[model samples]
Target: MYTRLGVVEYPEIDTHRTTRLFTTDFNNTFILFLQLICFSGSLTKSSLLEAVRMLATYRVHRLPVIDPISLDPVGVLTPKRILRFLWHHGQDIFQPSHCIKTPKQLNIGTWKGIHVVYPHTPLIDCLDILLNMGVSSVPVVEHLTLRVIDAYCRCDAMNIAMQNEDFKLKINVKQALEFKTFATDRACAVIVSEAESFYKVICKLVETNVHRAFIINCSSVIRGIVSISDVMKAVVLEPGSHLNSYCISHRRFAEFLFETPTMETQAEEVDNEDTKTSCTSRSSSRTLS
Candidate 1:
C-alpha cells in the first residue's frame, strides 16, 4: 500500500525552519515555494562543502554553475554526472594518498544553459514549462545578466494550490512566492574550483547531507555537477556487485496487484449480514420471549 521510498522519511532540512514562506496544494504535494539558492563547486573542498550544506538544507536536486564575477549561467550539477566521474576513476577515489584531477581539470565544453523562467512569468505558463520539460523546478533568472535569482518547483505549486484552493493559474510567479519574506546572505550560487579531490567532494556531500554538486573551472566557468546516486554507483561497481539486484528491493511492491480485500472476504461479509437478518426476524416473531 506504500512505496519503500515513501515509507522511510528521507533526511532533509525541515522546510518550515529553513524559509518563511511555505505552500501546498489540496493533494498535499509540496509546491515549489521558497527560492533559497545554494551553489557548490568541483574545485575547492571548502567551496564544495559549503555548497553541499546549502543544497541539503534547501532540498534542491541540482544547481546551475554560475560565474562569480560575471554572474552568468553556466553548466549544471547532477547525480548522473558524479556517477560517470567515479566510474572513470574507480577505487583510486577511495585511496587517501592518491591525488587525482579535480573536476576543473575536465573540460565540460561551452557552458550549455538549462531551462529557465523569469520572476514575472505567469504560474500557468511556468507550469507548462515544467510539464513540457519534465523538470521538477525551473530557475528564475535575471533576463539581462543571466543570473539565477530564484527557483520555482512543482512542490511550490502544490503548496500554493493548497493555500489558495482556487487554482488560479493567471497569478504571476512573484505573487505565488509572496508567502515568504525574501532575503539573501551571499550570492545564492555555490562556487568551486577544479583543484579539489574526489575525497573532498564525497566528504562535503556526506557532511552536508546533499545530493548534488556543481563543478566550475578556475576561470570561474561552469563545468558540470555530481549527485549522490552517481557516487553510490561507483561504490557498487567497485565491489563487483550486480547493479540489477541493487534495485531488487523495489520489486517487492510490484508483485502484488491489489491489496484490497478479496472476493471471499466480501462473500463472508454478505453471509454475516444474512445471519443477522435471520436472527432479527426470528426475535420479532417470538415477541417478548
Candidate 2:
C-alpha cells in the first residue's frame, strides 16, 4: 500500500531558511524556490517487494504510486506503514521466521562509519552534518564518555522552523534537545540492545512511531542502527519462503495501505554516484526512507 503521497524535496533549503522562512507568511510561496525540472523516482502498480527495494535503494522515506493512465498519484509508500503491516501479518507470511533472530544474525542495520555529534556541537553544525552526511539522525554523545544521551533527527529539524533566528544560531545540540517547540517534541533517542530480538526491535519502532533505533551495548554505546527499511528488507527480501503468491494476491492490499490524499508528496531521489557510494558505504546507517 502507499504510505505517503508524492515526494518533493528542497535540498538547497539551508538551516537559516528552514528556521526563519518555514513559519513566516511567505511559506505559501516557498514552492517557488524548488527546482521544478528534477525528475524524482516513482512507482506504477509495482509489487511490495519492488517497493521495499526501491525505498531502501534510493534512501527515500516515501514514493508516489502513480496511476498509469492519468499519471496522477494514487497513493504513497513508506517504510513505517510497510512495517506496521508486517508487524500484523508477518507470522502468516514468513516460513521459518527471521523476525525471531537478532539483527546481528540477520546482518541488518549499519555497524560502521556512523556519524555522531557531541552535546556541545553547535546545532547549526549538527544540522549541517545531517545534510552533508545525508543521514536522517545522529546520536548525540557525551564528549568525555562517548555515551549516547539523545539524538538529533530530521524531525527535530522541523522544530527549528518554529524557533527564533537567534535561538537557531546560538543553541547547541543539548539545548536543542531540551527545547520543546511543541508538547510532543521532547523525545529521547529510541534505542534497542544488540541482544534484543528483531521482534522486540519492531515492537519498539512501531510503538515509538520513530523511523529508526540505535542499537546499543550494555554501556549504551551505539553499535548500529536499524531502520524500518532494514526491517522491510529482512522480511520481503529474505532468501525464499513463500512470497510470490502473497505478492501477486496483495496488489489491492498494497493499494489500500498506500492510498492517501495527494497533497504533501515530495521526496528526494538521489541519482549521483557519490550519493550511491555514500549510501553503500554506510549501509548500516539510518535513512529517512
Candidate 3:
C-alpha cells in the first residue's frame, strides 16, 4: 500500500536549533503542518527526490513553493498527494529524462492548485470530493499548507449496500426505479468531519468489514476520498479493529447481485423512422471475421 509519495508525519522544528536556512511560523508549528509549497514541473516530478527526502526527514506534513520573500501556497506537497499522484499519473510525475513530447515542445500535464481542504474540515465534505471530483483524498491546510488530514472512500457503503439479501432486496424494491443507470449503487461513505481521524476510518471499515469509507469535510462540503488502503497505510502501525462478524456478514452478502436488470416488455419488433435515425447516430465498428 505504501507508495513513494506523500507525506508522513509533520515535523516539529526545534526552536533551539540554530539555522539560517530554515524559517518558522505558527502555520508550520501547530498540527505538524506544511508551510512551504513544493512544485516540480510535470517533467520535474522525478527530480523531487531531494525535496521529498527533506520533508520526510523533517516529518513535515506538507511543503509548498513560495516567493523567496513573500510566502504563498502556489503549490503544496503531502505524502498522500504524492502517493495518489503517482498511482494515477505513474511514477514518472517529474522524470525529466522520460519526457515523451517532441523536443522544443513543452507538453506538461494539466495540474492546478486544486482539491485542497481547510483545517478543522469535516468528513461530509470529503464525500463530495470522492464522488464528484473522483479523487481518493484531499489536502488539509494550515497557514495555507495543503497537508492531508483525512480521506474518504465508498468501500464502507459498498459493504453496507451489499448486505443481507433480505435487506438489499427490500431496499432495491423501493429505490431501484430512481437510479440513473440500471446499475447498483447501494451504500456510500459519508465523512462527518475533520474530527474523524484515520482511526475512525479504520474502525468504521473494520466494524463493517467493508473496504470503502465515505468522507466529507467540515460544513458538510463533499471534499474527497479516504479508502481502506489509505487507512491501512496511515494506520499501519496501530492495532486495527476486527470485524469477524461483519466479515462473515459481508461474505454472505457478497453473493448478492449488484445490478438489477430492468424488465423489458415484450413488444413487436418494429423500427420507426426516429428509431432508425437514433440507431444510425450511434457509432458502430465492424470487424471482419
Candidate 4:
C-alpha cells in the first residue's frame, strides 16, 4: 500500500550498518574480552594430544577440561598456548606410551574455576560475563544463527522499562548510548530445509557456534532446528551421533549479550544466511539426520 502510494524505501540510511564493530554495540564488548585463546586440552580430562586435534581441525580458539564424574568444567586451554607449548616445550607432551598408564576416567563436576551462561540471555549480557569473569563463551541452552539473532534488538525491551517514573531518571546520555548500543541481528530462529546430511549442518555450526539450523520441506516451512546445544549435548552425552567426538578444544559459546557480527562479510551473505522461516515457537524436540 505504501509502495502503491508512491512511497519508496528509506533512501538515506545505510545497509552496512551492523558490521562496523565501532558502530554496533559489539565494539565496546570486545574490550572486555580478557584473552583470545589459542590452545587445547584440560588438566583433568581429555588428552593434550586430542585437545590439540580439536583446535587444529575444528578451527576453535580453545578447549576446556571437564571432570570425569560430574562433567563440570575445570581449566581453560587454547590453541595458541598448545601450539606454543608443543613448539617450544616439546618434551612434555602427553602421549599414551609416555605415562598415562592407568587410563583415568573423569567427567564435568570434578574441575574448578569454569565459567558458563545460559543460551537465552542477551549477547550484551554475554559480553558482561566475559568482561567481568575473564572467561570466554558460556554454555547456552540452545544454538542460534547469527543472522536470525540480528533481527532483534535490546532497546526494544528497554523502551518499555524506561517509561516508568523511577526508570526515566536513570537513563542519562551515557546510559542512553549504552542502552542503544545493542545488537540489531535477527533473533535466532528455526528453519526446515531439504537438508540431507546432519554432519554438514554440524560442520557449519562448529565454524560458527550458531543456535539452530533448520531443515525444511518443499514448501519452505521449517522442519527442525539443529541447535549447537543439541549437537554438543549429543557429543558429550550421546557419543554415537557425534562424528569427531575427540576434536573439540576449548569452546566459548553461550553469550548472554545479543550476538554481533564476527565474520568480515558483505550484506548479501548475512541476508541469505538468515533462515526464511521466522518467529518460530520454541520446540523441545530436536531433529537429527
Candidate 5:
C-alpha cells in the first residue's frame, strides 16, 4: 500500500522581503516556506519512474524515502545520485522492453553514506559544505543515530548568495533562523513510505506541486533518497515513456527572483567559489568516487 501526502495549507510567500533581499542588502531578511507530503516504501519501479516525471514537471531536486509503519525518513534521493547509479549499473535497466521489472532492479545503496550537517550549524559553514562538496543538498540528522531531521539544498544556497554582499562578513544557520529566512518548516519536505508503489509516489509529487518526496521505513527511519533525475534516468532507459508530458515546465519557486543575467552570474560565481574552499580538494576525490 502507498501513502498519499498532501499540502494541508498553502505556503505564504513573503514577496516583499524576498525581492528586497535580492534587490538590496542586509537591510532585508526573512523567507517563509510551508510543509509538504510523503511517499511510501513499497513503491515499484513504475511508480518511481512516475515520481521522476512529476519532479521534472515540478523542477524539484530531492526525494525523501520513507518507511511504511514508523513513517520515518530513511534516505534522500537526488538527480546526481540517480545519474551515478545508472552510469554504474547499465545492464539491468537496458532490458528488451527497455523497462525496469521492479524498484529493486536498481541499486539504491549508493547514497547511504552521503554527507550531512547538523541543524545548528552556521549557514555560511553549511554553504561551505555544499559548494566545496559538489553535493546538491545536505540532510540535517541526529549526530548520534544519523536520524533525519531537515535539509539544505542548492535553492537554499542561492537564497543565501543573494545576500552575499550584505552578509559577506559573518552569518550562520541560527541567524537565518532568528530572521525567519527560508522555509525551515519540515512540512515543506515531501515524504514517501516503502510500501507505496513508484506510480503512486509520482502521482503524489505532481498532485502536491512539490520538487521531492521523503522515503522512510516502518520505524520512520530513512533508507534511501530518490529524485527526478533518478526517475528520468528510468524513463531514458525505457524509451517512449515521455516524462515531460506529466507536469508543466517552469522555473522553481526558489529561482523566481534571479531572472537577470547579472543576478544569474552572481549566483553562479557564488556557487563556484566553493571550488577554492579549503575542503573541496580534500573531499572532491572521495565525493566523486
Candidate 6:
C-alpha cells in the first residue's frame, strides 16, 4: 500500500504537547496518523521583507499568511517560492557586483557555533536536535575527521515512516544515511567551499532543492552554513550600498505579493481544502473503530 500525506490546521492543539507526543511515540506510529501542530507563527497584512525575515528567523520552510481579523489562512509562503520569485525579479534590482561576492566576503550565513551530528548518533537524538535547535537539517560528520558525510533532516523522519517495519528510530545516523540512496526525495548534505561565490551557492541550493549548504574549508571541516534566509538577507537587507537600491526595487515586489492569486495558487488551495476534508473523515473513522 502507498502512504499519503495530508495537511490540517488545528488551532486549538498545543504545540508543546504535539512535540512531546512525537518525540515519545514516533518510532511506533505512522506519520499520517499524527496531527500536525499548528504553524508556530503566521503573518497578517505583512510585508514581503517581514515574511522573509520571519522565515529566516524561525528556520521554518513555510508559514501561513492569514487574514488579520478572521485568522484564516490566505496563503502559504515558503523559502523555495521566495527564492524563485527573487531569482526572476532580482536581476533588475540586485547589483551584479554585489551578487558576485563570496559568501565569506558578504558575511552571510552562520559562521560560528554550527550544529552537527556524528555517524553513531541515534536517529531519535537527531530528531530531538532538529526540534530544539529550530533547524531543518544538521550535517552528519565523521567522528574522527569531523568531515561532513551526509545530512539528517526533518524530511528523513517521514521517509522512515514510509519505509518497511524494519526501519526504526533506534537506527544510527550512518544507517539513516543508507536510506537516502533509495529515497530519491531525501535531502542530502550539500557541501561548498568558503571561497565559492555567493551567487554560485544560491544556484546550488536552487538546483539541489535543499534548505542549506555546508561551507567547508580545504580539509572539509565545516566553517559555516548558508541557508536560503541568509541569501535573502544578503540580497535584500545588505548593510550599506544595496539597501537604498533594493528599497526602490521592492515596490514592484510588494505589488507582486499582493496581486490576485494565479490559477496555480487557486489549484493548490483547492487541493489543500480537499486534503483537510479527507483527513477529517479518516480521523473520524478511526475514532469510531
Q: Which stretches of candidate 5 lie over 4 Å from their true place?
A: 1-105, 108-110, 164-187, 237-289
Clash totals for all models, in order? 25, 18, 60, 57, 57, 0
Model 2 quality (TM-score): 0.65
Candidate 1 lDDT: 0.44
For candidate 4, lDDT tens digit of each residue in 121-201? Answer: 434444344446533333332233222222122233344234433333222222433344244343333332433444455
Which stretches of model 4 miss by more than 4 angstroms?
1-180, 184-192, 240-289
Give RMSD to native, each candidate.
19.7, 12.3, 26.8, 21.0, 17.2, 12.6
The residue-by-residue lDDT of candidate 2 on 1-289, one tens digit each, is 0011122343432333321222222322333322110111234534667677666666778766655445456777788888888778766654344457788777888887788888777676777767887788888877766677888888888776676655544467788877867646445789899989877887899899888898988998788889887777776766433555222233443343345334223212222324554444344233221
lDDT of each: 0.44, 0.64, 0.35, 0.36, 0.47, 0.63
**Which parts of model 6 have CA positions greater than 4 angstroms off?**
1-47, 57-59, 66-74, 160-167, 180-183, 237-289
> What is the per-residue lDDT of model 5 for residues 1-289, given as tens digits with 9 covering 90 to 100?
2111222322322121222212212211211111112232322222445555445544456665544345456776665555455545644554443232323335422235556565555565566666776556666655555556666677666554456345431344545544435655535446577566555454455555444556666766555565555556554524647543332222332234334366557545654654354244435433322
| Model 3 lDDT per residue over 45-141, tens place | 3334444544444544555543322333357666555544444555333334323321112211112334653433333343345456755444343
Candidate that beats the other on TM-score, 1 or 5, i.e. the better one: 5
Clash number for candidate 5: 57
Deviating ranges (above 4 Å) for candidate 2: 1-44, 92-100, 183-186, 238-289
Model 1 Cα lDDT, one tens digit per residue, 85-177 = 554555464644323645334322123445556666666567666667545555565555544455666656665435533434456676776
Predicted structure 6, TM vs. truth? 0.60
Task: Specify the poorest-scoring 10-residue window by lDDT in model 4.
Answer: 280-289
